[model samples]
Target: MAPMYDHPGEHAADDPIRLLAVRDTPLSLDEVHRAVGDAAAGGTALFVGTVRNHDGGADVAGLGYSAHPSAEAELRRVAEKVVANRPVRALAAVHRVGELGVGDVAVIVAVSCPHRAEAFDACRMLIDDLKHSVPIWKHQRFSDGTDEWVGAC
Candidate 1:
């Protein structure tokens, strides 16, 4: 039998837990999107963050991401807040660590809600908060033979 869902405002304990992950492997948007899929959701919003080839007016050669051991735990905490404050039916977020070249997907986030606006708002909140609060750092190698560390917040 199919499971039932909360109509809109009920904080049902049976609501599906949001997906949160940080790994030293390839990241997939398809996986995150699937995680947030729900039969009761009328809208889904996804955000994919990619490693661009430039940073701060410099041509970026490559990049690497590193995370503290507590990164995953902090990720879950951030997602928890999103679920608590938003009208989210499902949520998922994943971040990739290790060496990455241009155009690699660095992070993927998704949110599902009963309405499109809610989904968009929740998804944006999840990603922005994750970026600002998480203890993940980016090491950027510029094409001019210089590098910088950024966003350890």
Candidate 2:
């Protein structure tokens, strides 16, 4: 199923998790924090993935991301796993596609929990799992004027 947005105030008082995806655009850390905020949450952890100026030992010029049509479904699955395995009060994952330059935000994940430990653990696991499981590929452009397609890195 496609990712759906919950109407404002529509979720149950106890409902405190969310997930999202978007095309190429900058990610706002404040927006992610707000999305994971809740009266019941005491801790929030966020992860931001950015296009680095270098990869491996090569100087990177830019990158382009492409994903399978089922990317959202895979993302949802990963979010569910996080919620099930940890004391997550709220969770979200967003990834950008298309072309990106150095320093562009590639992915953002936020998690809220009753405590700092769980929030930190769940947030890290979410990013690691997403990178491994999501069918998104990146094309890396090197300063040497060569391009190579790489799996999530």
Candidate 3:
């Protein structure tokens, strides 16, 4: 194997974190894709989370997302963790909050790396950790007049 730092841009790599935000507005896949663009990256992986029409055998009418004050900070921590462990050339993530209809986008994440596998792995880790650890909660309204809360409290 070659030396780790020998990869293009490895010696002068800018902060791998390209973008991180918790927004009440909508997310844009194009924006995330642009943010993670890097000349040295051989592959870029993106993951988008959308509000589906059903969940757990219930018909979802709509949903609203709320975030704690620490949510953005927690998101950054998760992004930083991914950067520290992966050969990430660039990374971007955004989560949307507030009221949203079915089929709305909830989150967007992208990672760029020197190889396809590395990009895929880092992108997955970034999104999974953000979902599990960030202080963003979802209030899902069902067609049956019931509601459920999901995600970190």
Candidate 4:
């Protein structure tokens, strides 16, 4: 699919994949928001994923995230896919690794587009694809003395 923008052949310098990272530090909403700021974009959409206290009826006692060496490259690929055939003006995504407590931001993604609907769609696609395809695994320690890994290949 062809890329969407106001000017054709002029977006090479204005790449849409603005920010992509896999960090051990805490994620920031302001950073993601600032990365996707575009002059031409009329709407910006954001999604924040947090570590919840419970999952699948199990009380999560602790959580940690580990990522493969290629996780950042894989994240870039996911972001590219979201901007490939869409009207996305800019996009940013960050996933946190290492130990985290409940209510901590695990992931943050944002997208800017010429319209609200496009921004929403692109942002949704960005986060969904990142979670499913990125080489990041979650280790969950439950209150019942059981532990499990999620999204490990």
Total backbone collisions for each predicted model: 0, 0, 0, 0
Which ranges of candidate 3 are over 4 A from the true structure? 1-13
Candidate 4 whole-model C-alpha lDDT, 0 to 1: 0.83
List, residue by residue over 1-153, the lDDT tens digit for candidate 2: 234332224445665556566556666777677778867878899999999999889999999999888888788788888889999888878888889999999998999999998899999999999999988999999999999999864
Candidate 3 residue lDDT tens string, 1-153: 111222224433467877777877777888788878899999999999999999999999999999888888888789889999999999888888899999999999899999999999999999889989999999999999999998762
- TM-score of each model, in listed order: 0.89, 0.90, 0.90, 0.89
Give the Cα-based TM-score of candidate 2 against the true structure. 0.90
* Candidate 4 C-alpha lDDT tens digits along 8-79: 223456688777778888777887888788899999999998989999999999899999888887887888
**For model 4, which pairs clash?**
none
Query: Could you give the candidate ranking by lDDT, starting with the highest?
Result: 3, 4, 2, 1
Model 3 scores a TM of 0.90
| Candidate 2 positional error at 40, Å | 1.2
Off by over 4 Å in 1: 1-15
Q: Estimate, for each residue in 1-153, the C-alpha lDDT of model 1 and write its tens digit.
A: 111121222324565445677877787777677778788899999999999989779999999999888888778788889989998888887888889999999998889999999999998999999998888999999999999999862
lDDT of each: 0.81, 0.82, 0.85, 0.83
